[model samples]
Target chain A: MNESNSPRLDRQDLGKIALVSLRAARMIMESGGRAQVIAKSAQTVACGLGAEFLGLRIGYASLAISLGDDANMITRMVVVGRHGVNHRLDQAVRRVVQRITTERMTPGEVEVELDRIAQTTPKHPPLFVAAATGLACAGFGRLLGVDWLAFVPILLASTLGQHARHYLLGKQMNPCVAAAMVAFGCALISSQGAKLAGSDTVNLAMIASCLLLVPGVPATNAQTDIMDGHPTMGSARAVSVLMIMIFATAGIWLAGAILGVHP
Target chain B: MIEAVEHLAHQAFFGGVAAAGFGILFNFGTRDLLWCFAAGAIALGLRTLGLDAGWSLEAASFVAAACLSVCVAGFLHPRLDPAPDMIALTGCIPMVPGAFLAQAILGLFALTSPNPDKEITTVVLSVEYLLRVAFTICAIGTGLAVPLHILKLMNFRGSAAE
Candidate 1:
């Protein structure tokens, strides 16, 4: 009864939950949960912390959340730090969300788990990512019904493009430019296979290699964002995807121009 | 019909394999790879069915994407990650406009060349390719989104107080 009656303790606990909940939303966004997921999860965290109402606003790189009844309310705004997809981290956040709401984990416990998850490296190593990129592109070549000879070039170009992407992104290069640069490099390398083999092989290699640079995530997000009633964010993402595509095309064109390979 | 079924299976297998590979690049959990394969196989298979039924390519893609989103958001992610988009987006890898994108670029190159002697046939073909590429992008997005919206409305109501 004393535990329930202590208003000061309750206030402190609620404050901790609000802070951690805001952090939870930021983490979710940073790990690839879109605005809708962030909004929903933030609200849930706030609710589990005994909020009567929750107001959440999600943005491209930031989120603001307010929780609790009118007079005793708390509001927090957190800046999303990183924007990369790591499903394992996303899973950890989900685990935290579930535990807090269901098992009623305290704020301190949730923070510890969140920190541990943050420290855990991505399950898929860098080598796997590069190798998988090559395999995926080659697989796409087979799926496209291209000749068997295209595999060598596709493999080479895709892996190289992927590495280039990793390096460029790590350097904090703009995604649009990174995509174009990666595409150009891939096309240039793939064009050599054309020179060695024939036009058919070059066509297949070029298509497969370019597939590695395709902005599937942004395009998908644009759609989801629009449907989720955040049309402005969706439009922005759609336009960004378009810009990336246009830049990638420019890269391919430049490579073709240099290599004297048209079509 | 047997031939069509064979073709469909072939498409599904390659599409699934390719999507699984892309999943690795996206850092999906090892366990989620199989789910990605299923998403790709089902999406491509459904798209093929729609095409065979005389639907437009965009229409087929839209339906296929919806199926994928439903599977990912409704069934798959609940057991895996919170972000269904991760695997679902990778699943769409096989359906990307790879060939069409290259064609459109080639067409644009031919059209944009300073040489005035470019063929009229080239201009016409480039326009077709560009339009198709644009439409396909739109189709993939809208397709992946509609089912997601439905799922969100049904499940994610934000505050538990609601």
Candidate 2:
């Protein structure tokens, strides 16, 4: 029975509930959820489990949560992992939160569900993602005035770059390093390869091929977070975006210099 | 006029493709991807129309983002909608001005090169492009933030009433 209806929860019970809510919050944060969203989710899970009060605090790398009803309360903090965009996982977490509030899921059951959501694979395979990214960069190239004949290089380069990024990330390479390497390779291919193919849009192809590495979402999210009153987390995201962009730009500059291409 | 319409349509279609592709890359599901595609098309189409009407890029992008945010808030079921911000952000991906950012970066690199004869034109162009990027991003953020805040306030009121 929930504490709201049953006897007072013991410290152990409060600890368990607190941990469960903390896990939920961590999952959302790791999935690139906004600070407000993460706090709301944690609070929802805690309250639905019969906690009368929840004190949730979110940071860039960790989250702490306290759950209590009356004299008994427990606080727990765990360092979350790297943040990345995973809309499916985020949506799954939302559904779980909904179920917890509406269906009265037990803390144990919610933990199991969170684990399942954590392990949920990407909706599309790597190759398909690569192809889509390739097509996307080519589309961007065309919009930027790349000729049809020159579009192939951007497509091929971005596809290969995305594949390489996926592979390197799978192997646990640093994202900055992976992005830099992929950008370098993509620029090299698009610039030199376009020339070889007799395409006149080498510069555009070179610029477009590396577009997949841009941290557009995170950059945008940073400003939104700051506006929404999460200055610390927003600044953290902004710094990360700047780091990735700097490294990727360095890679592109190096590749262009080697190929006698000026941006 | 017909040629202009065709150009706008073509650009809008590619914008949708760009958004859908990014949606996939971000792991949105099939249904959400369709929404993303539509949102992207709407955003880019509106921006193109604004541009044709003599709006600056920053103003056009701001209008597009605000309109898209409102559409998501107004049309989608609050409980059923996947993150509205995600849809808006992904749709605005096409308007990110990647080329301009790259150009700014390149200009900065040029200034760093050990050439004493580096022209004032390099400094001026770099600053101009950097400012453009900053203002455009700021516009998109403000555009998204205002409507989303309204949505949040509405939801809060609804919950309070209950």
Candidate 3:
């Protein structure tokens, strides 16, 4: 005769699960895994805790989820549905408590699930795309009277700018600030390259490569979101993306001015 | 003649494979890869047909590729939702203005610092070059979007009726 119904997850098990999740996220992000693949991988890894994986978007909201197998395995699964930072933080705390109370799961099981998820996450090709684009730009710069030495600055600036944006995003910084910072850093580097290399080729490569970092796709997605009838969400995303782009552009302009590079 | 065709085919294959690989990396399914390859192939074929009317050639090839993608999407939607990002991204790769964009930025630096006249001319050239790049990007995006939009509308209507 069971009178009480309470969900339980051992604290050790929960900590292990969180570790696995974070590791999985690191793998996906580093691998340039697409959203779908990441979602699928997350789901597979969290299966041991009878937890499901949900899809993550650029913004904090719009998390999509699917129920895991093993129905009635626990009292209740605390799904961190579509919510903001507050909700996510709450969910995290709750999950920790739940895991502490429940029975522990084997680490080997968790590792195996994580491995499976890693195998499924797709490799991102943007690195290759950027490299190819850089090479082509270097060639074109030479044709346009840019010196070979100029390519180094451009390469460094563009790559650094991209890496900075990624780092800022991971830290949950304001999108606008991230974009601006990345663009500005890229511009500063390019200008320095110009001065050092005594050629504008590096500047050319940096500027061109940095253009790919513009939040164009996100802007487009915001438009699509609006069209799809999510006005509030869409507008928020659009405005945020716009601000980011503006900051980025301004950063570049300001950096150029400081470096005494003519517009 | 045989060797020439083979060589062209090889280049086309590499281009298509590279584009398709990009699609897969972006999480696009097999259908996207197929449509992108088809688009690339069509663009190559059009080039062989002597359609060298400047920007018109690029326009026609892109539109053709986009329209073909729409058709493929429509035909395959019943089976799967083929990732739009994959198709659009890969299909547009052929027309990306990598060289032009680089040259434009370089041209910006080439402007004479002391001489206003030469500087003005260089700035104008840079602006013109950037505008062309913008146009090319917009054209490819629009070409892909329009057909896909139409297909979506049709599917919406079909679902509504059912």
Candidate 4:
């Protein structure tokens, strides 16, 4: 519909639109959308729902949005839940945004869509994830100079570490602490296995096995956000990556000391 | 020549495996995982070729990632629904300096021990490894970002004209 044929939405209607838009924005942000994408999506959704303006502020931990002109605007802020990658949710939100832009979606419908997206669960089971982690770290070990003899140790160590991490995270453990523990356990196990195999690449095995603990998503996202002009969010992600690295290193060091394998 | 090709092929295969694994961890679906595998394989293959040509590690990584990003944006983005960044960035995982970062952190931790005189070499090695990690990461980031920036600009222009 063109401008004249567009129905005039009152402040209340705009408020609902704003809430739904904010919900979409929060979902995208929490699901690892970059700041620019989040802002653009919120604006697109709000405008599609008949709001003239959307004032969006995206932070690492929260999102705030305003609807309507100066005096008549309704603003809302929501603290985002745990930030992590959820590709299905990301794709779902993108679909909702696309729908809103192309087809006329009521605020209620948008909310329902957002709710479904929010309820999205992990795509792969824990066992599958663990198996993938094993294969991945083994590949990484080969790339990092681990000999074929040490590959089995890296695979088993990473698989067990991933399981340990999955269990700890399910128990509502702090992600950093869980990562540290997993790293320590994987390093200890891999080092011992390497020794048993008489492989000289024990240190390489230890390093490659715990690589599943590296914060690859956040580290990459940090750089993207920083380079894309979202300094605040970028810095937050960068700091989190640094902390994980430190904690994982501490775990590796402790394991090495116990195993008498100093690299 | 055949032995060299075999070596590169082996690395590429492992790179794809690693990328697929990371794709699952990052919550990607099956199709996206396949794309990740391809991206990883291409990236590692290119980097391996570069290294064989005597390029520095950081330079080779930057070039490989940049080539991957450009290919993603120029050829793949329109056909694919998922963001190009996801595929390209995940592909870069096989190149991460996890070992260097770990060694650097370990060296720093070792410096706090009672042997000040023994720590000079450790400090130097730590600094070296830390610098390598930082430079490598920066190279990867820049390589990824440059193409994305160009793509975004093209998109902006296209949208503005509409």
DockQ for each candidate?
0.56, 0.61, 0.09, 0.65
Q: Which stretches of candidate 3 lie above 4 Å from their native place?
A: A1-152, A194-203, A223-237, B1-81, B90-141, B149-162
Candidate 2 structure quality by residue, lDDT tens digits, A139-232: 7887788888778888899999999999999898999999889999999988887888898888888888888988887778788778777899
Ordering by TM-score: 4, 2, 1, 3
Query: Which lDDT tens digits does candidate 3 get at residues A124-156?
Result: 455653444344333323323456577666666
Model 2, position A65: C-alpha lDDT score: 90
Candidates 2 and 4 compared: the better one by lDDT is: 4
lDDT of 2 by residue, B80-116 (tens): 2646668877888888887777778888888888882
User: Model 4 TM-score?
Assistant: 0.93
Ranking by lDDT: 4, 2, 1, 3
Per-residue alpha-carbon lDDT of model 4 for B4-60, expressed as tens digits? 999999989999999999889888888789999999999899999999999998999
The per-model lDDT (C-alpha) reads 0.73, 0.82, 0.47, 0.84
RMSD, every candidate, angstroms: 4.1, 2.6, 11.1, 2.5
Taking all chains together, each candidate's TM-score versus the true structure is 0.84, 0.93, 0.48, 0.93
Give the Cα-based TM-score of candidate 2 against the true structure: 0.93
Error of 2 at B119 (Å): 4.1
Reference contact recovery of candidate 4: 0.77
Per-residue lDDT value at A17 in model 3: 52
Candidate 1 lDDT over residue span A1-263, tens digit each: 11233234345566776778888888877766666676667776766655543577777667777765535767777776646666677667866776666665667887888888888746776667877888888878877776667777777888888888888898889888888898888888877875576546675577677787776766666667777778876777678667777788788878877877764
